[model samples]
Target: MVLLIGSSMFAQSVSAADPSLAELKKVLQSQIELMKPELKGKVKDLSMDTKMSLMAILAMHSRYSERATLRQVMTEVLSDYQSVLAGIMTDNPEHTADSARRLANHRIPVGGLLPYLGMENISDERLAVLDSFNSSVEGNALKLADAAEAGDMVKAASLIGDISSGCVGCHGVFRSQPGVSDLLSLK
Candidate 1:
């Protein structure tokens, strides 16, 4: 795969160039910018070496910024979300309510989500965006719990869809990792 080859090349370059983490990150950002047009379906004759270098840089950069605790919390939330879905499908109100409540009240990591997300300079606008996403998710989650408690599976199903949308929308905005569609030819 191109990504694998790119990462291998990047690892080699990191050792060869001996650049600081900051320098590598700078290169990675620029490379991603360069690839944007190509990624968006424009035919750019960017060199394979340059493309591979970008991949390698991204691979190396991600190693330095891995968020273990945040990942763990997200894993827990995902599990709870699945449990809620399971409960709803099986018509178990207690199970659905409990999982929905846990999802709504999932613990925020120390220093909060934004810091863990590596937003160095927090602006009110960014904070507002995050708040908007969080509010939608939490509000819908609570409504899900209420609906489950009241044995209204129809309402609970709709709330779950809303919660899924909120999570995906927030991740699209804040997550640094490139998705499959972002990296590979999609035709």
Candidate 2:
């Protein structure tokens, strides 16, 4: 009876370790799918906005890697970002102002990744990047979230690039962390 009780407790403990990775992946994928058309429509420059979005998504991917099962899903999501950015960059350089307006609607989700990453306890260097980004001209432009809502893709894309640069700078630091090199390389 003692051994059985011990085994049962151990099983429960193991089961409670983390949420199902598959479920997490599914949720993330669904979110992306739902956001895509909206994303394509609202941004003037897909190249810049896509890169910014990928950086944000990668931040989430970093968190998902904490679990083994979710690692595969994380990889898939990262690949999607890469592919989308590549396609956008390679395709057209010009878009209708109306399309840009539509894409701007996704600003909330696009920008929301910053706080999510912060919740993961961003490094000091990363925090600095975020600060710099917030104070930048482009960042200031985004403060005109109202302008973006009014279909100002020009202002929105500019701000989005600044945000993307911040993410890249931080990720550069994140990847260089002593033990994370191997993990980052998977992307």
The most accurate candidate by TM-score is: 1
The root-mean-square deviation over C-alpha atoms between each candidate and the true structure, in angstroms, is: 14.3, 16.4
List candidate 2 segments past 4 Å from native. 1-146, 176-187
- In angstroms, give how far residue 69 of model 1 lies from its true place: 1.4
Estimate, for each residue in 1-187, the C-alpha lDDT of model 2 and write its tens digit: 0000112222344333456533433434433333333232332222333334433433233233222222233244344334333423443223322232222222223222322232233333333354353344223333434444555545544554554465456455433322211211122
- Local distance difference test, candidate 1: 0.55
In the range 128-179, model 1's lDDT, one tens digit per residue, is: 4554566577668889999989989889888888899988987777666422
Off by over 4 Å in 1: 1-68, 177-187
- Best candidate according to lDDT: 1
Q: Model 1, residue 59: what's the lDDT? A: 38
Per-residue lDDT of 27 in model 1? 43
